[model samples]
Target chain A: MKMFPFVRGNKGNLVGCPVPNAGYSMTINIGCARRSLHGRYFGRGFDSHRLHQFSKGGDDSLTDKVDETISKENPTLDQIRTVKKSMSGAISDSVLKVSKLAIKDGFQVYEAIINLVKDVAMKSARIYMVFKRIEEDGNQIIFSEPSVVDIEKENFDKTVKLFIITKKSTSEIESTISNISEIESVSVEKFTAEGYQTEIPAVASILPPNSPVIKVLLVKIGDQTYAIAISNIERLISLDSQNVKTIEKIEIASVEEEIIPLLDMRDYFGNVKISNARQNAVIVEHESVKCGLVVDDFIKKDEVTVKTLGKIFKNAKEFCGGAILQDDSIALMMDIPYLVEKFSQVLKINVNIGQQHDI
Target chain B: MTFKITHEPFDVLTFKLGEKEYAIDVGITEMILGKCKIFKVPNSPDFLKGIVNLRGEIIPVFDLKSMINLEDRENSCSNVIIVKIDADKTGFLVDEVTEIMSIRSEFTTMKIVSANYIKGAIIKQNRLISFLDLQDLLVGKMSAFELGGKVG
Candidate 1:
């Protein structure tokens, strides 16, 4: 019986296996296999009420090992230029820089790069409580939205591994297992490596089926789940000597609709335009300019009126206006002109994100 | 209220989907490649046409025609204009090679959507062109290759 061949290791999760019409699916429940997440996060001695200051995201242990795995390969600029030609001008220079740095540092940062994650911000402490079954989704089910019960952050970074799951519905729970991303390691039950019937010890986990085509690898961060989609799963894998714990359980959360993907883009070309820019960001409109500047993000909207904060940013590169937000955080209103001039020397225009293929 | 391009001329690199014309600011137009090999990825977002290898890097391309609720036309014109517009590394596939137009100033170019994030539309070739409205194009879509953001 060549089932999807992959099955969650824990027996409890196996109870939820092979959902109706869902072929090649199996769930296993390893109860509290790594449920010390609260102590790993909240137990940290640092005390801070802020998000960014406390936002040193992820228990970066195993990932650190993974990052270190590719340390020996010293990728060169010339190699990148050659790859770009193969990439047919899709890889942005910013992304290439990161790729080079990753190759130099022996890690891959360009993959699974989650940013601006506000919904699950510093409120990780609250999520910690949910891990203890103190909270549940709107349904009164006890294990509803099942969270990690005992996983900690340190154990995550030190010992966690990864695996792949494929073909899951949007925003729908992949498995009965709660929080699939937080588990440390897994076994390849029904996977084919290099077109061979081979099973590798998976360092990550995916939702199954959907990830098969894109080649996504799901990894655990503290007690959260994130997907790493790419073409070459091998180029993305990093080897670590540290032994992380096997996954106990995952809450299997789905990427929601209307969820905004965060950009790693900083200020581009200091020119701004004052149009619908009031929403996410403002565009600086100059009378003689051909292309205006685009602010990376919107800190605020509809405060007072459309006016600059009397700040002259002629020499300043990215920002022009300095307006205080309602939260009292001073946002440097971006200057598009200066930014463009600053980056004018850069090899502009390349797609740095995901899915690489050869045509 | 009227605004003129006298402030500045923003060059919008426009493209055609089937026979209709659409445009986005050239700033967001990352790569305008002509006719690459595209592979069909199962269970992707409906708008996503398939994946392509520029060289070794694989990029997911979206069909602008299919995105606008238009019917799929077989073998009309298969020129994929891969636009890496946002953080998602998404590609928008347009049909045929149309010239890039620099839009002069006009405030009425923006078309209004009925209660959606679509802010406005632009007029091209005398026809009311509904621009990609990138903000709206991305609003409800989930991330790539993830569950719910992927195909079941």
Candidate 2:
């Protein structure tokens, strides 16, 4: 009635027990060993039936003594070892059949342990390889968390997500990841520093504290370059001289089914009329009033820091400020709102004069 | 207050306006630039030359010869003197910056001239150098320009 001893292998691999002299193979149930180890490690109470399985060897006296030792609420290691020693004599045999069976079981257990160790080592090595590959591609693993799950109850699948810090472009990193066959997918997201609650702020807002830069469309008027604030611009249209109609000497152009007054900037800047060159008009809006500012040509758009023209030019209402161009030349920023307002007033005055003449 | 004449050598920057040499206090001068582009402002007075970009700051430049009623001649001068007046900065187009001279207070003689902007005259090395009162010149021109700008 004495139960044979079973050694608990790491990661729930059950080491088979040796056979007794009765020509019967006995096994310590895997569930029993697992339960005992689980109880020992995880502090769970062990049930009497799950603690051990008795062998049918008919040694009642030794069985009663071992049972008496193991029946306590918690059996110590020494008591378990004593039970193992008492059962060893009956379980061991000097015959080749018994020896061969025992050796086969030992080989199976040894193979299971080796396979477990090899599995863990392979996983760690693969993780190291991936980390090295990322570093070689100019990326650093800021953090990594790996998890293993059972796929189809037959294979163990490991997935690792790595947070990488890199200066390389997103396309470059994507290409690098694509070359590695083991990578399933890649996701790129913008990263901000800790305690940064909102998304990235606008570039203008982050510039020098009090002086914010403004985006402007640079246009050529006569020989000078002028910047019109992009916020005030409605659109840019090519000036068609045939479509331009004059009412009471006030030039107007129809755009988007609406007629808007056109102010020739060449005349305003005192440049001689270029009769042969084509002109462009910038449709600008201010206080719900739209006007077309005619210019010689359209230049590029840029972000510029504006500086005020000092007291001497304080009365020059047509210019709000000036910006230093990249070429070290200055481009005056046109006062779009003021210009639109003034154009509307001129139109009103001309219309009034026409009405007076008709009356 | 007592009138005491002491020989304290104060620095003055001399520059040629026309055929004559003029001096202004060196402390008020910010910088001297050579041959930079000046952008003409529309509807401004004739004496108000234009505006110039002085290290990203827009300062208006005035023609010194035209402001003081000198005879109109071919202007080949390219020197500009940036001066700070009160809280504003302005530039003046001059023919040439001669040199920085330290003139004693006693060498300056109070004299009345046709141009009210001349505070006095300084005798240096047997040559007459007019000491310019820049505050009166710039302020007077600014008011006149402002008046004309308002009227136009």
Candidate 3:
């Protein structure tokens, strides 16, 4: 509890008196560092030094000033604090407090950002280490066996496990670690052959390759099975109930309330004959514009693995990729965005509401 | 005219279209699958027989008889050569798969009736078997007939 004396200066600015004998120069320097950090990192217009002086004064008149500055800086500072807490390791209170103050001054974490959400508390915190595999000249080196190395704990009181590695990206390690669960903390320590030690950090959550099971609506078109993302579908309407009108040479379906142009996928694919009359019309929305897809029959919705098409169909934008069905058959994944854009042009359907004057 | 065996014998998959026999490199032929149901595509070129689903892979079927400006004789052609061309798996519809005959590369000459897709001709079993470019016939080039238009 050191007292910092404030003196009123010209232009109503309160200047702090330099107490040389108080041995609080370090604290003043820390305050100055925080001010520079806040200005540089936070991009806020005001400085924290002035706010610190105003807060230390305990004057009722400057209370609004302190509150205003804190209110303005709290969101960004809290975000930084939250990220720091997400990092794998038990961060000391002094480090957290200092980091919070620094963050309030606008310290941004670039290389590593820890998400301090409820699920990522200290007990279940995930630790990640980033390693730089590539050099500037793009020379290659054989990767050490087992890319992920386990870290060891030295101090029993520490919640973080320290890992040592030679080379690998921090992001890659973070993604790999995120697939795992129920970890207290992780500390990645890198020791170069030159005896210099560097600490790289990362945060974790379930990443791609293992996650993101996509749901696609499988449809039977002729003898082919096609899949479209269910998210794109607005509603499934039976063809028997609606009268499809041909407007501007485009087949438009007038559902209960909305008028959507129907795109026959068989026509688009150039199938010679209709094996069966299309039973359902799937209203698809793309880029805020809605259209209908008439299909032979609707198959059950399934969560399948999406496989990208080979180079032959690289120019075929209509097919986004292919999905392997449970029965070991490939179903072409439809690119709704491409189909909507292409058919909309062919049918001369107006994309915007006001532009439908030609219709 | 027959030439000397200047090259080693290589296998060519022979198939019939209309009155002529066509041969394609065996490497390009996946399998000679019998005629399956072909779904006709409206507004597609006349040569396109529609599409066939083999197992789970949907392959676009092209009529070889139509490509060479020949009339479809009847429903006699019952075989489709499922060939891999570049990245696309396409089906080449033909009347019949005659046999796999080994012919020398030298015996196969590009002197057959000049066509964009016809590579040459090989004298196999006393018959002039036209070497057809299956890659060019199927997934290789986009012919005018393959152009899809708005359905009527």
Candidate 4:
């Protein structure tokens, strides 16, 4: 119970005072050591021994002050309590001062900078380790594969979030943000018209040898493509949609970067006439003739070449025979003659002509 | 050269179909007749006046007034003509037979309206009488007629 004299400073703070003839470090110069620690506090390691001295008031100056009082030969209990109280306050004040000075000294500013290193010295075997664990909780996402290029941050509606990438971008990282709605993580951002052209990128095919492609009609509408397959081609004579919208089409001879549907033909060209009266169109002398069991819409008058469409009805694809269009997107020519003949039969109309008509 | 010029007496049979008045060539007159009921044919041409039986002959009667784009788009019929066709000959009914007259060759006139469709005129007592070329008018043009069409 060695005690310090209760000496209140003008600021009303309890500070310890040295006993007579017991002052130490008049030769060792411990304050100069504390000055060096200001830089050490921010360095790679902390000087734990010196730090402990600061925390425990192990400074020879503080010891000399206590030793001088101990020579008083076990002072009264009241005197012991006063010394303990005053010593604790002085220690705290010194720690805060070093922390502030450590800030200006270009080292890491820390509370208990020296004391912390001494306490955790066993954990790191590093008495010079300066960083102290204030408070921490285990959290944060653990990614499986860090080599997956990078995950992206994006926004939709109003919420900002992250998006993962599986492929390289031909466009900007932000552009991939437009596709964020397609990802499963964000269902609320789902785009109604799914599977856009940006996703199903087109590959260049320069294969000259023609492969037997099971043909279906692909209709190019705006940027979207539609596929239609006709088995009983005769059943449709006319399906008219007065929904007329005029599109400004560049009348070039070739199709450059045109996106066509997987297996369908454009509705623009549908019915083809066979007979002479139908050179311009299928002219029916019998006026009342209309749709019955076969022959419906007036598909365009064009010839689709001979290529047997294989067992592709499973895809439920739509197309006529493959007739190359003015543009290379390929037109599957429709058999309006066959369709008309079949349906004309069910409608009780005769389409079988004995004479050949010249165009 | 036995050439004697004289005005031949021809009747200008006038009649009304809805509102307009018209007269056909009387020198080519076969018969001027009135309403003799008719039979309807399905899917017939718009101007097909109907088929009529006259003197045991099934004559196809056409209302020239309506057929010639005069008062068409109407349901009323008043008159018809019974012309002895070099092809099909039978007397047909018309509206009303007015009178007969004699006109000089100078009064006789003709003209073509549209290059394809025909239109002609004759002066009768200060009134202009139009004679429509039925055959040419029958060959009407629809939008399907495009350039590079096989005219043959």
Candidate 5:
């Protein structure tokens, strides 16, 4: 299988470097060509011979250096062997580093390519080609259809799989793919032009015409019932005082081997009487920072239309907005991310202050 | 021989807060709503009673008693007077809305008080009614109220 080298500071351009042979290893030049040229080659199936030619033309300094050493008059066999071994070692090291980088930055590169394709599709009015599956031999089998492409492959192989979205007809695409000897097979499924018009509008109309309804986990703290968007909540767990631990005056609870900082809703909201009743904690993740919000009880999850808290409450950061419940009572929607961030910062400050007091 | 005293009589909606009577211009009053559930907002000042969902619109209810530092009676306030200041609608929780009466300009006097919200005092009958400037009370004075006060 061929391995693609992803160079750092190369602006996400996939530099195709053929794996070195047993001897006479080729040195890789990390400098990549412009994005336009990369896109052009990527859109057309990658021809290994053309890629090799491109790499050779881009830089030949290292290769030329190795050539000059071998071409030296009366060069010993031992010297030649040493040079080959060193070249092989150097190429192997570069390959290992590039492979690691490729794995780490693979998702970013995929996102960038997807965004690029979206921009192109918006401008050209071309539909996306669905990536159907990848064969055991690393050949990506793509199904070309009109609109809504589903990508099934999680892991990628050496050959850069290009989903060439185009306005061209199936016959035209098939003829183009036929010219590229690298593409093993081309399957054409003819969709009528009217199908394209109908499908595109259907996709656009799928978005709700009215204000979008949000599903929220209704939670009660004190006399007030608040709604936390279900999307922000990771899970809900029952908690007792035994489960809670205080570190530097900050309450934390360990759930499933993960220690989460807890912010008591009753305490945070300044409820006069702190209840000794059984409590539940809603584990919420905001921008990857996890925090557990302690609440008195959990009501059933329901979909509600959130209305903005008027001008007077415009400065209230604790609540994002409020939604009228079925009982005609309004439940304030908790701003999860903001509260998590604010709570974390407060705990950090308190911990620091405690440390200073000890000092 | 008759003495005709010509003075512009503007309407004022009078409401009771504790033992004191407060009046705001009737023109600013949107509607007087009965006792509805006021959802307590976290990290809000004491003067901010809570938010009320009237129809579909969420309007903030301010405790007028707390704003003016009057002794707060327990669960006595049922009337929420919705007033429009500029483009914003705000609700004031008071004991009760007594009346909407036309008070002549002659009865009103510019009395100096510590509270900047009170524009003047109108002497109606034997009782003195404090004329409130709703704009001055609610707008640009949010920082004056202590934040993170207990919410019921």
Candidate 6:
């Protein structure tokens, strides 16, 4: 008997074989065989009587020659085996090259796989991802392993299906999977990705959940530790040797040609007299007003997690939030906009004129 | 005259001042902040200890001892009770929060008329607890503004 032929059957039936229609589907498990999942017709047509004759025929070459049945609705067992070999060859020739490049650049095999999937899925409207890894043996012959799937067929339904499982839009996932290398075809149902629990590993452990890492300038006044967002600071100026002039009761620090108003935070911290040594004036721009915050000392810049103050401290305008240091101490995070407004109200000194006379 | 007392129960926070225990309605108490830096506002009243930054709000803190004409003593640990009045908030310096007491209207017996701020006296656990009326406390003082006294 010629191994399963490429003959078209009815809509539901793929093989023109004489078998009970109820038990028609069968899965072929191959350990080292390169197989194409186009199980589309791999399981059809070959009845027990003919299968018995083909195994006993002793024509091993006939088992490997079915390459023409790529789109054949009723493909023979030999054609299915040939499709697997064809897919394995394509994977080794194209997909494996990209995977090797990613691996060489310090990316893990899994990460490379995710990136490849994302790249491929960007092109099509197929939301379901059905993938089979191709393994290359020592003889350089590529073989198909078992189908490795993150998503399944039941997920194709509109409710609690593919879209909801991945927490991604149907169109987005469809396009991504459609773009996968050597992917033949896809079928799906409408769905949603909202509130889906993702499997991707979160980036940093030190940062608070869902909060972005931010750089801040730490300033110490007396016993209090305060952090100002680095983006708000213009520069740090040393006032030890520079001739700091007090104009109109506001200390002035000369930087190039600009004179900025210097206000000591220690005055605001309390009546405690702390030694002002090795202190650098932090120059910050508030609205159009440029002012310097004279402090006791400057700690190195650090990345911190910002948490909002509780309702009890809701009225605290100068402090927008707080960050926990490595030592488990709370460092108050300054609200620059509010601080500037408060300084203008309390100091009675004009902010616009702080830029006038060149120190 | 026998006054009818309402059966509704309310909570009050009791704290120590000198040798006496004072109570404030828990409804008006916003928070109990730990020791913090209190900046002294210039030209303020003597009862106004200073202004402390609770979170970021600058609230005037009043010395409870001096506010009631008692001898001012050094508070080893400065615990501030942030209270809301009308629409504003102010902080009052206290030694520490003693306990929370649930009291009915019938528990309050005598109303002190010497100062309008004193609501009445109530006996809790065999000790006399005086209730301080926050509204009258703010309105009675002409120098309340100097004490960071905000009406609300």
Interface RMSD of 2: 35.4
Candidate 1 is graded, for docking, as: incorrect
Find the 10 residues in a row with the least total lDDT in model 2 chain A: A107-116
Q: Provide DockQ values for all models, in the order shown.
A: 0.01, 0.15, 0.04, 0.00, 0.19, 0.01
Docking class of 2: incorrect
Report the error of model 6 at residue A320, Å: 4.3
- Candidate 6: list runs displaced more than 4 Å: A1-214, A256-258, A268-278, A287-289, A304-330, A335-359, B1-13, B24-70, B76-106, B109-117, B124-126, B133-152
Taking the tens digit of each residue's C-alpha lDDT, what string does model 4 give over B6-84?
3554455455554445555564466755555554322234455445544433355555544455634464544556654
lDDT score, candidate 2: 0.57
The segments of candidate 4 whose C-alpha lies over 4 angstroms from its true place after superposition are A1-344, A347-359, B1-12, B72-76, B90-95, B105-108, B115-119, B133-152
* lDDT (Cα, tens digit) per residue for candidate 1, span A250-301: 1111122211111112212212332332222122222332222222232212
Using alpha carbons, what is the TM-score of model 6? 0.41
Ten residues in a row with the worst lDDT in model 6 chain A? Answer: A134-143
Please write out the lDDT profile of model 4 over residues A1-359, one tens digit for every residue.
11122111111121112112222111221112221111232121111111111122345554454445435543432233244333431222222332334334433321111111122212211110111111001111001011011111111122212111112222322333233322222211211111211110000011111222223333333223222234222222221222111222211111133211111122222323222221111222112332221122233433222221211111111222233332332333233333333233322111101110110
**Per-prediction backbone clash count:** 86, 0, 16, 37, 0, 20
Candidate 3 local lDDT, B1-152, one digit each (tens): 33234476778888888778888889878888885777553344567775665664556788888777666557687998888777567787889998988877536555343465777777755788778886665543443321211000
lDDT of 6 by residue, B88-150 (tens): 687888888888889885355345566667776767667988779765775566334312221
How far residue B36's Cα lies from its native spot in candidate 2, in Å, is 1.4
Kindly list the per-residue Cα lDDT of model 3 for residues A221-312, writing each as its tens digit.
76688888887888888775337777544688778877888887766676544644445778898878888888877888998765434333
Top candidate, metric TM-score = 2
Q: Please give the ranking of all candidate structures by TM-score, highest first, separated by commas.
A: 2, 5, 3, 6, 1, 4
Residues A244-336, candidate 2: write the lDDT tens digits: 888766788988799988899888778886784455999999889999999988999998776656545544557766777888788887877
Please report the candidate that would top DockQ against the real structure.
5
lDDT per residue (tens digit) for residues A51-111 in model 6: 1010112222322332233234444222333343333212111113322333354332221
Candidate 5 C-alpha error for residue A329, in Å: 0.8
Q: DockQ score for model 6, please? A: 0.01
Q: lDDT of all predictions, in order shown?
A: 0.30, 0.57, 0.48, 0.28, 0.54, 0.47
For candidate 5, write residues A1-359 as lDDT tens digits: 11112111111112321222211113322222222211322222111111111110212444554556545654432343344333321211122222223335331111001212212322111111212111111222211111111111112221223323233455654554444323434554432111111000101111111223678999888888999989889999998788899986578999989999998888878875455745699999987999999988899899887666754664455665676788888888887765786676556434433433332
